[model samples]
Target: MTSQHEKNTGEFLGATHLEGCLFTGEWKPRTLTAPVMEPATGDQLALIALADPDQVAQSAQSASIIQKQWAATSPAARADILAKAVEVLAEQTSEVAQWLIREGGGAHMKANFEIAVTIKALRLAAALPEQAQGLVLPSVEGQTSFARRKPRGLIGIISPFNFPLYLAMRAVAPALALGNGVILKPDPRTAICGGHVIARIFELAGLPKGLLHVLPGGGEVGEALCSDPHIAMIQFTGSTGAGRAVGQLAGRHLKKVSLELGGKNPLIVLDDADIEAAAANAAWGAYLHQGQICMATGRILVHESIARAFTDRLAEKARAIKVGNPVSEEIFNGPLINQRQADHARSIVDETLSQGGILEAGGSGEGLFYQPTVLSGVRPGMRAFDEEVFGPVAVVTTFRTEDEAVTLANMTDYGLSASVFSKDIARAMRIGDCLHVGLLHINEQTVGDDVVNPFGGVGASGNGATIGGPANLDEFTEWQWVTQRDVPTAYPI
Candidate 1:
């Protein structure tokens, strides 16, 4: 890191630029550069050259060539490298948190949580190498058949801006541990945390050259990765629109794709639940990371009996959360990823207010720091209730019955995560079963994720493909069945 890179000084988003575009074994320079801006303040972090098609093509070619070498290494060797990456990343936790907050507009807690999850993900991935095992199948009198898993040649990861570190590493660690080369294309806005940081981690871990390459850019680079001959699979995390496009391209190229798209997740609060606790859970779910999370509670459904109580407490909780520059650990609600997201969040609140929903806590903001908004009486017909507001805006809708609550929750085309709150665990589980979601919790909120679970959703939220746990073994590798005989069989007539 240079002085320019470390310093917070300059004309907000000044002319600071670096020449590096690709990081294979080392930083490779290119003429095309893109600016990485701080979402909270619109300040320039750095301008780095973006990788072009030809540059990425060359790297991808080499990565595919060396991928075999990485695969041939012992599983213990692979696991050891991943284990070392965990230590390397842990040592720089604070430094990486700075990149996350300064460049990606993540608050202190969000930064720390993201880094912690990343560390755990690496540790989990380290164990995956030894966990991969083949299966034997019943065979004929003189033959044997078995299935073995082999690494995909190369994987392309296009991670989103929010939760950059963990999302990317959740794929990178597993792919590398499974012995596939990787080409990462992080959102240009968060290249440092998503691209640069991973490169440094693996580099220190002594990963072979060309095994992991970081190329940060926009749609062009993403398309190039999808269409590249060497990239056999793509792991994408972003909006459904972008994911749909990536899916199409990957499909056209006859490559495997894992789409972790947007979510309009819902969290339900029944009258039998503890009102204050449910409100607290709802507030944290919707406001954490400014609601810039796929698992963020998009809609909160409260029983009409306790709707008044829940709304009041939720509003109070929303206003109490701190909001400001993410440089400090005290600020609870930081800025959205950029102006567009902030504006979009405001629009959701404003549109709901205009449509007869009441603004319970906040509705106005300046720049990228939108207030932790709470909208009550928001019905399904309103934008806030129906659409995914990827910001710190919590939309509240009241339900007359459990059936209505389930109906409202499952009304969306997106089904990622859902939560049901009640004093009785059995009833909560019953309601949870009725809602369409990939993840569910009776006493928990929709916003938290760990590295050990198979994380993903169905419908527009995702394509039913999971990311963590045993799913990683399947996602990063292909199964090949082998059959053998002790001697040559008699020829058929």
Candidate 2:
């Protein structure tokens, strides 16, 4: 193992640029150069060049050619590689966390948590292959049939910057477990950590060359990856707009697409809710990662009767959140991934304030810190209510009735995740059923996630699954039907 100083010696400590790892059924290095920056303070991380489109095409073609051969490898063998990869990931967690902090600006604890979640996901994927089973049909007329699972062809995985490692693995592992070749594209902003870690893990695991490739570039590379004819499926995690664009491109090629897009996820603070618990959860869920998470509960809809109390408590909590460098253990919030995101987050807050909203708490701070802002009196037309605010800004609105809470929660085009903070289990369950979202939380914030349960959305939040629950496994595998007969029929009568 190389020393930490030795490992990062050549690369820019804060100036790391975009890089690529082109795996050809076997592990190998390929290069595309482009520049990336740190959002905390404007600093050049690295200069990256776009991978040769022709090379990307060739990589896809190579995977297309070798996919069946790799898929033919026993599931046990595949699982072994995944397990090895997880071991490698565990060894490199610290290094990966550092890169995540430099690139994405997640606070130390949050970055560590993301790394842990990634490790768990890899372990789960490693275990899934052995558990792949088929149903055997009852014999009919001396014949029987069973349903089997098999990998789809090459799967292109494009992930966003927020929660880079976890989200990337969320899409990649299931496909790999089912024996599909993966061409992965990490978000340009946070590519180094995820791109480097994945490449190193697979290399250490001695995976086949063409099985997994990490292609890191900007929108052009992603667009190219999505449209590549040789790729069988696209699993993407990003904004709704980008997801729509990718969906269209993939659809044009008649490829399967799994888009885990944007969220303006809501939390309904019913009158019967626990104010202290809700406030704490809401503060963390909304401000963690500086609120860059897609499923971060950005909106709080409280019962009007308790709206004043909830708003005051939530504002106090939001103001108390510690903000500092992503590597600081004491800090709970950090800068956005880049200036563009910071500017966008600020713009949303400004728009909300200008549009008949009251600033109830911390509104601004240095760098990318928005001070865990809370806005009240937000109406339906305001962007704060309608659009996804990917920052430390939280919107609070009041609901008079249960139906109103449900309606307010579902008002946005996003249907990723929502939470109902009610002590009454029956009311919470009823509200959960009515809310249009992929995941629902009772007496909790909207950030609850389970690897064993499907995580995705309906409506504009995009389609398909990121975390492959039991049903989600079908996303990576295709169906095959076979018929056998023991007796032969006479040709002619």
Candidate 3:
């Protein structure tokens, strides 16, 4: 029987041992290598080949060649291939989820959920080709005019470590379905599962060679992809700072770019909200996967009348969460991605406490593991209230009026997602409308996404472009207007 390393090397990389980037259907080694470590154990899992600027250029050129051919292929064929990819992904869900848990430091349930969402995204992308339609325009009596969607050639996808599979496929599936070749630069931390696993699945689904390339590395590789002229567009998911760099690079090249960046999302619990239900959703939204999600509830805005009750229940729920090994089925909170993140979370909590915030639940753990923490009496000046803490810490702030709640919710530079929980649908909707976020949830958690809905943000969160559903196709394609006249027309001159 093959060991884990041997199996990953042979099956995933097609080499005796994992070596380098998968460029244009070939496994090529790089001069430099980065070590991929398991966050939970702090053990080196493998060394991934880091792609330099020259290698990034080569991958872009090759993708350009393949994209032209793919774009010329029939839409029906593309849709069919995407449909087959869904089946291939479904078969490997368990294996992929295991990789996510080990490499990404995610809970088992969270990993599985990521895989499930990826499958749904694939299915949604499969139907896009058939549903894609152009519009007829009114024209002069003797002329006809219309617009059609055309592929944008090569798309460069830079995905984050958290929810790597789902984030990568969120762009990959749609780009492929729309007949565009993709160069995927997954996070160096999740190269094995996010980059290697995805490449293998697409190959099994019968995607033509060179159409999908996985070049796993650090920021240098992403910089190369973003700056390459051959790459027509870039779809990125990461922190606001990183997204800013990507946007700047893409803008310099005059290329289309879509960014799904950081979020200091808020969850508002109105006085009329069910206290138990609000607390439960808050726990799930803020503590799931140790709160590494971009849309995790960073701030909880509760009505003054119920703030104490809500904070009490939220603290109780946080204390009960199993914070341990990600592989354990009973565990809900897992380790952060690395020591730095864990340290960052701790520092944030300490700063909040220093600023006169109350720590009601937990504030201590070992190594990369951080306990689920709840902070009350958090004010605007506190770091926990103003900054995005991508950890299992929920900061609660009390507001006396609905206006104050909306003001508090929209008080951050980040505006990715927000949730309003109230028994009255109209009241919840009113609050949600006032929050300056890209996605708003009513009577639900902020950490939620649908494959058929537009997923992105505004302000510092991201650029205006979106991913998922029909928007996916729109993001990867351009419109071409065609006009025809049966008879010759006279020139103005």
lDDT of 2 by residue, 240-281 (tens): 999999999989899988888988999988898888898888
When summed lDDT is taken over every stretch of 10 residues in candidate 2, the lowest stretch is 11-20
lDDT of 1 by residue, 1-493 (tens): 4466535432211123233556877776677787778777777777776887776798799999899999999999999999999999888887788788898887887888899999999999999889846899999989999999999889999999889899999999999999999999988888878888888889888999788998887788899999999999999999999999999999999999999999998999988999999999999899888899999999999999999988999999998988898886479887888878878888878888999999889888889888888898888789998899999998899999889999999999998999999999999999999888888888899986777888889999988757998789889999999999999799997
Spell out the clash pairs found in candidate 3: none
**Candidate 3 regions with alpha-carbon error over 4 angstroms:** 1-4, 7-17, 21-23
Each prediction's number of clashing residue pairs: 1, 22, 0
Clashing pairs in 1: 33-49
Compare candidates 2 and 3 on TM-score and give the better one.
Answer: 3
Question: Which ten-residue region of model 3 has the weakest summed lDDT?
Answer: 9-18
**Per-residue alpha-carbon lDDT of model 3 for 79-160, expressed as tens digits?**
8999999998888777677778888888878888888899999998888888746788999999999999888989999998
